[model samples]
Target: MEKIAIIGSGNVAWHLCKGLQNEHIEISGVYSKTFANSQAFAREFGLEVYQDLEMLNKAEVDLVLVAVNDDQTARLIEQIAAHHKVAYTSGSVNLKDIDHPQVGVFYPLQSFTKGKKVNLFEVPFFIEAKNMELGEQLFDLAWKLSRKVEYADSNTRSELHLAAVFANNFTNHMYSLSKELLENSKGKFEHLLPLIFNAVDKLKNSAPEDIQTGPARRNDEQIIAQHLDKLEGDKKEIYKIISSSIQKKYHEKL
Candidate 1:
């Protein structure tokens, strides 16, 4: 595609625009439900800003990237699919659910935060299209943005999205809880930074199952009891559930 128009000026759009610009791909303009955001993003990128969906639908672009929220994505793609080649960036949105022939998925399997630049070269791009021709086109386009590109259908993409929630969202929540506990005990969260880094670094060489530690993994009842006694409410409940799961998984190995 020679020129592409992007919908939504959120975190995904912010990073995508940068990645496309780096590859010298011409982004026709950007459109958003919020006019101020569209103006700001367009001004930042030196591109045209479309005031409404109707205006964007008539734009001279080969592809339109729907980088909006998952709930709004299908509706937006449905509106513009007839005019331009459409691809969305949602991992959970089923391709078949959208009744469009030219629709596809260009899901980036990474969490994006505005102003926090990530290495798009390493982020995985999952492509799914209605037909082989559109699929191949998206694959080629994704390859330009990242080294890791794979053709995954809606089901596989949905599974990957679930895994990502556990790996990234749940893990980050754990870190947040750890920080809260440390603060309550008058301990510095920074002191645990090295330990956290070491735990993650070890996973690079060994599977999580093989590298399991802690009282729960070791099946040390006394230590587990002691730890559990220190926690209360939802934290205590979470600890109980996760510890039980870990103990069960490592039961044979222990």
Candidate 2:
């Protein structure tokens, strides 16, 4: 098994390490700038922790997975350029900015949290590389980690990142808003949990347009107007915009 070193101790790094471990790949060590984070992660994974780049470079590893944040990715790549085949776990960063010839992207398109177990096989991995050979290597790595692996160029990957912001992050914000509204009404937010789960479940079998429902889908103008009246503050404006968008989409489908 090829040895892997991860250069961050955040959610993405943690999850990636767990996935790689499940595949029985050897994790040589983990490098984090913060000693506490590095120590904690190292203890959990039973791997050495390096707080310095020099220490990490000394470790026996074939690949270095950089899971640092967007702003720090380029700097980290430069710091580790000469040591090993460096790959980042970012969907937004351009691979050209990194100096390493073997640099690539091994972006897993899923929200990760520390202590949460994520099944990598269910998550889509978007692989990219500077050359065809490196691209194939990245794809093979992705395939080992996920059942759904796709080869995407930089532009396509960036576009997917934008779409993810809208589909996942923005939608999550909307869920929080829903919870807030329900709480304000002295209603249990848990009531909507099943509906939320079912909405996502429906997406697996049907297109979003085909599964859409509520007043907009039925063209019930009266209920729409009533909903608009019931909504208050910024929420009312947001409701109007979303309803308008839904209405426009519904009309386009006609």
- What shift in Å separates residue 144 of candidate 1 from its native position after superposition? 0.7
Give a tens-digit lDDT track for model 2, residues 70-137.
88998888877474787898989988877776788999999999888788889999988777776788
The residue pairs in collision within model 2 are none
What is the TM-score of each predicted model, taking all chains together? Answer: 0.96, 0.91
- Candidate 1 per-residue lDDT, tens place, 18-114, comes to 9999999999999999999999999999999999889988788989999999999888787784858899999899999997779999999999999
**How good is model 2 by TM-score?**
0.91
lDDT of all predictions: 0.92, 0.87
Sliding window of 10 residues with minimal summed lDDT for model 2: 77-86
After superposing candidate 2 on the true structure, give the runs of residues whose Cα lies further than 4 Å from its correct spot: 252-254
